[model samples]
Target: MGMSAGYELARRGFKTLLIDAFDPPHPNGSHHGEPRLIRHAYHGGEAYVRLALRADERWLELEAAAGEKLLERAGVLNMSDPDVYTFDGRLDDALKLGVRLEMLDVPEIVKRWPGVRLPDTYRAMYEPDAGYLYSERCVAAYKKLALKAGAELVTNTFVTDVKAENSIVSVRTKDDTFLAGHVVLSAGAWFKTLEPFIKLPIRAVRKSVAWFEPRGTLFDAGTFPGFTLGTKAGGYYGFPNIAGAGVKLGRHDTGVEWTPGEPFEPFGAYPEDEGYLRRTLETFLPDSAGKLLNGAACKYELTPDDNFIIDTHPHHSNVILAGGFSGHGFKFASVVGEIAADLIERRVSDQDLRLFSVARFAVAR
Candidate 1:
């Protein structure tokens, strides 16, 4: 979100300076996963569909500007549990938004994705245009464009303090203190690092991803679609074997609670993570579970209700806060970037963002 926001702001003729605690596209952040799924099912809420629609456009624009294929058009298969929340609003939004999506039954899913085996309680929503984003390439493209647009990027600079007062925001680093007319805090898991200064209902938790070599062409990208499923155990998501590398799988639920100070412990360090994936495959994609090629651990910053927060700080209007994506936000990064820039410019966005306000959490607290 920070990279995309900096790029947009710089493109809008704002003198932008993007500073990262570590050089971006590194393995440390949520963005380091092999690829992130971008779909419009938007079970998060219908409020997100508009932003997702805009983000799809923005991603296309970025791809055209960068002249690189950043997004894949592989379809998405949303496998939901009828025993749980049955009406996934995406069914309604698909028609309203003119998105070409179809509802698939258990048999249809099994027919479409030969490797997937699900119970009768599961149904699927298929969106043809939904796909995956090559995450690292996206950061590189945004960085290149932002730099070309006259934005300065400083990496490996840890932020020590962020002070917003009297129309000016001061950000202190280990080496220097910088002041700006406004600030956008898009800090991910480390959002708590801001401390009592910014109280948010966010928790940083460990998450895992595992890659498995497919047994046959049955699980390759050309024939299979990226999918998310609600099993009896929990929710699981995965991508097809793109370029024959392997099938990638992950879980949505949080792992162990983590903090910035002691964050780098690998997810696989907990043997249960691997055991869970093995069970997930043995039950769902039995044939595709050939060999575990590799695994990775990352952090997920979450909110209690799993909704996001995108609003101005309660007391400081000049300080905009953008965090709490709750494991499902990269697809909206483009639109969020535009909204962040719009907030900084003090302009009303055509799309409503009231659902993401900070006050909602405060009232609940």
Candidate 2:
């Protein structure tokens, strides 16, 4: 998010300065694990569909600018019980925004795509336009663009303090201090670093992603599509074998909280902590879940409502706060980049962002 925003701002001639604790393509952040799902039908809420629509356009723009295939239109399959809340709102939002999508039943899904298996109650929603984003490459591309646009980029430099004085936002790094006309606080999972200054009610949850070799031909691109299955327990999402290693699987419910900049340590409390996740392959996705090949940790800065907060600081208009993407925000980096830049440039977005404002948290509009 920071990289995209910084690059967009610089491209728009903002005299931007993009700083990060680590260099570009760092794996310590969320833009890792090969691919991120980009679904048009947002299950969280309908309002997100608006942001996602803009995101689609910006992603294409970035793809064209980078001269690389950043987004793959492999389509996304959503599976859940009829009672379970899925991207039903995504359909409404996409229809309202003129995005092409479809909702399918079990037979229709099975007939169209024979690789997946669901319970009798499970239904599906398919979005042909939704697919996957090449996260790491996109980040590198944005950073490159930002640098080419004459934006100063400093890496391996941690921000220690932020002092805003009536619109002159100043950021203090470990070694030096710099000031800007406006500041965008887009620190990802490390958003807690600004707690003393912003007092945001966000929590960083340590999450993991696991890759499993396919059992049979189920992992083929013709059969399996990137999908999110909503079980009675929670949501489990996966990607096809885009990287040739295997199918990528991740859980949405299991995560631990840690302070910003803290070293990550794996928990070995429950067998399921490691074993159970792998065992799920034997039960749920027997064909796809074979040997647990690799797993790595990422972080999610979550809000109570599991939505994002993308607005200015309630007390500090000069300092824009654009974090708390919940867990599924990487797909919107393109649009969010433009939105952050627009907010800084005092331009208006066609999408209504009132639902994402800090005022909703009682910070005073």
Residues 217-320, model 2: lDDT tens digits: 76766467888878777678888776567888888876787788677765343345456566655555677777767777777788777778888878776777
- Model 1 lDDT tens row, 1-365: 99999999999999899989999878877888668889876765668777788889999999999999999989888887888646456678656777778888888788777788888778788889999898889988999999999999989988878888788989989999988997888889988888666888798988898888888799888788888877667888899998867888899975889888884787568887788887888888888787888788888899888888898888888888889885788888888888999988865676688888899886321
CA-only RMSD, every prediction? 1.6, 2.1
Give the winner by lDDT: 1
Clashing pairs in 2: 272-276
The whole-model C-alpha lDDT of candidate 1 against the native structure comes to 0.84
Candidate 2 residues lying further than 4 Å off, grouped into runs, are: 44-46, 266-270, 363-365
**Per-model C-alpha lDDT, please?**
0.84, 0.79
Candidate 2: deviation at residue 68, Å? 0.7
